[model samples]
Target: MEVRELLAQTHKLPNVPDIVRELIQQLNNPNADYGDIADKVIKDQTLSLKILRLVNSAHFGLSRKVSSINEAVVMLGMTQLKTMVIASGIAGSVKEVDGLDLKKFWSDSFRVAALAKWYAEKSTGVDPDTAFTVGLIHNIGRLLLHITKPKLAEAIQTLVDQSDCSRSDAEMERLNFTTPEAGQALLALWQFPENLGDTVRYHRQPLSAEAPSPLCATLHIACYINAAIGKQQPLEEVIAMFPSAEAELAGLPANIAAVSEEAMQIESGLDGLI
Candidate 1:
């Protein structure tokens, strides 16, 4: 399929659920009231309940702990709220891609989000919470793409593993659409901030000079390292992806991305706690 055909076809894609739309809009607005946001969250029985559970979960560092939606909002702040919103939407939103492995995907996404958050804390341009969420959702387009075009998804996977090709480029060659492109489209329809959608669309192509979101560039590097560490992509391919990202992240700290075996063990312990 030509890239133009894929773009034209995806126009008919479905929008995210109403709850995500509302959540994204609220989060994008810096002036949105927390009380009002809390009210909207509480109205959704499932979301409200999940927020409460997540607050009490070991993953969160609550000063005094929480047992209700209101408490979660006050304790976690907007970024955490946004994370839960994405998580809630994620739980029920996606359909499985027959050839894909959900467990691996979640593991990689979670680890990447964590790693991204750690990196964000050391950086100046990005927000820790937002970076974490970005890492988690960076490849979200791949999920929808997998469902919409499983054969192509499978072929992309095979090419990624067998050949020394970057996942996005291989996908583009096969499906005529990168995961970022699909993700950007989906996020826009869901009413997410255009910056987030744009980041998702261009993370792999950060050198496009036309790229505007520094946050997206941050996310792209985090994901590049994330996939490399988890044995999800070839190291050589990861090296190939880093030059533009290196340029994007000039100055600041020179942090090496590859996590050690001990790091994996640390992540495993943390995962059990989360």
Candidate 2:
């Protein structure tokens, strides 16, 4: 099926909570009342519980436990709270698939988010939170496919495992579209900012983007870093595979020897996120 057709199927697919959409709109309002945002989240007990659980988890490193949605908002700030809400929403959407290791999927995604945020922070003008948000959700298309097209998703995974090919190539061969494209379509359908949608869309081929984005290039670097670290690749190999080209485009340093260590650190950050 085409990207649009896949997107159309999302009406029946589960991902973000309805409260997240409201939270996004509220966050965009200049006159947004913090109380209203807190109240909105509290109304969704499932999401509220998830947020509290995440904040209290060691990953957040709070001195005191967060007991309520309002407390979480106050402690995390609106922007940070929004990020967690989306994170929790995505977590709730993940359903058990026959062959998918859901824990590993989210662990890797969190690794990318933490690494992307690290690179974005080092870059001149990129928002670290924006980078984190995109990194966390960039592979959402895979989740989407697992929900709607389990057999096809299974086949694509098998192709990647057996053929020593990239996931993008396997997806294109099986489904005629890459996860990035599906991710872009899903982001647009969710009414996320156009920039975020574009960032997800061209992350696999940042140079091919209509306008080269620091965020996109950062994502590319982050993905490479995550993969390299997870696979325990050598330092020289990591540099050759990641950072060199993508970091230049992102205005980051070419040396990526230390980034593997940074990526390793995010495994802890993934603690409550999954």
Candidate 3:
């Protein structure tokens, strides 16, 4: 199927939680208040509960258990709350996709988010929460494909396994576009931030982005670090493979080993949410 048709099918799948849309509006409004945002979140009981659970999870390492959305807002701040809402919203919509293990997919996504946020915090010119959200949602196109066109997704996977090529290469060969392209289209449909759309679109090749985006570069290196960890590559080799130029653009350290360790730690703490 054409990428356009695939994206149209994705739009027909299901709408994200209403609260997510509302929260996005709040994020865009400079006059929005923290209490107002928290109120919007609590209106969706399921999403609010999920957010509260994750906020109180060991992943956050909060000093006290968050007992309410208001408390969560106070503790996590609006930026982190927005990230949780987006994650919960996406999770609510796409629980399972054919031919994909949601568990492993989300696990990998969480690792990338952790690594990206870690790198973003150490860098300048990018918000860590935005980087985290971009990392978490980057591969949504793969899930979209599995749900809307499982045969195509399966074919891409087979080629990936047979040729031992990267997923981006397999996707480009089979579908005429990579997962990041599809992800960008989907994000645009969802009314997410343009910066986020660009981050997902160019994560595989950050320097190829039309404009310099520090978050995109951060995700690029974070993905590399995730791949290294998956292969159990030696730390020295992982460091050697670090995209130094991209890291420089993102203003992030190329310390692959340190970022890998942090990603593992964060991934472990986020077990229940995924």
Candidate 4:
């Protein structure tokens, strides 16, 4: 089925919370204040608990426990609090999918998010927080597919494994559209910024556009590095195989050894969240 058809069945897609939608709007609004954002988050008991849990978790390594949303905002800053809220909202939206390991899926996503943030920090004009948020949500299309068409999604995975092909290729062959396309569609439907949708759409082919997006290139390299790390490849070997073209596209320095080391260190922190 086409992505539109998949999304047309609104009941099949996970329901994004109103609070998440509001917070997503805040992501693009510079005028959004910490007090206002914290007030909004505090209203949602479930989401508030999750955010607090993450803040107090080993992820932040706070010296003292944060017991309130106001305190969390003060401790994490508006950017970080917003990222965590949006992430918690999105993850909480979907409870489960048949034949999918939700824990591992989120864990891998966090790795990509952390890596994307690392790359963004090394690049100019790209917001590291935005990069991290986009990375966390980039593969959401796969979850949408699993939710709407479990059998087809499973078939695509099977094809990917048997042929040792990329998931995007397998998705195109099976569904006539790629996961990035689906993810872009979902983000658009969610009323996220147009640039975010574009980044997700072109991440698989970061240079295909007339003016290549550094954010997209950053995500591309992050995914590449995460995949390499997943294979038990040594950090030195992974860095050795790093695509210089992508690094150039992202406007990051040639020597990223320090960035890679710092990014990889956050894996343990992310593990507690999952």
Best by lDDT: 4
Task: Kindly report which residue stretches of model 4 are placed more than 4 angstroms away from their true locations once superposed.
Answer: 257-259, 268-274
How do the residues 6-58 of candidate 3 rate in per-residue lDDT, one tens digit apiece?
77774556478767666654544667666666787888788777778888877
Which digits, one per residue and each the tens of the lDDT, describe model 1 over residues 1-274? 6434434556444345576666656554568665666677778787676667667766555677687776676676756676666655554455354787876776677777766666666666777766666776777788766666778888898999999998877977887767788887767655677777877787776657384566766766666566567665555565455545443462225434333222233241123212
Which candidate tops TM-score?
4
Local distance difference test, each candidate:
0.64, 0.77, 0.77, 0.81
- Candidate 4 residue lDDT tens string, 32-61: 675776787889888888878878987588
Pull out the clashing pairs in model 4: none
> Scored by Cα lDDT, where does model 3 land?
0.77
lDDT of 2 by residue, 1-274 (tens): 6877666775556667776666544533567665666677888887777778878887779999889877887788877777777667776676675567888888788778878888888887677777887898888888778767889999998898899898889998998999788888887888877788899889988999879988899998888877777788877666555556667888776565455565555552544756
- Candidate 1 matches the true fold with a TM-score of 0.75
**Model 1 lowest lDDT segment of ten:** 265-274
Task: Give the CA lDDT, 0 to 100, for residue 16 in model 3.
Answer: 80
Off by over 4 Å in 2: 22-35, 74-76, 254-260, 268-270
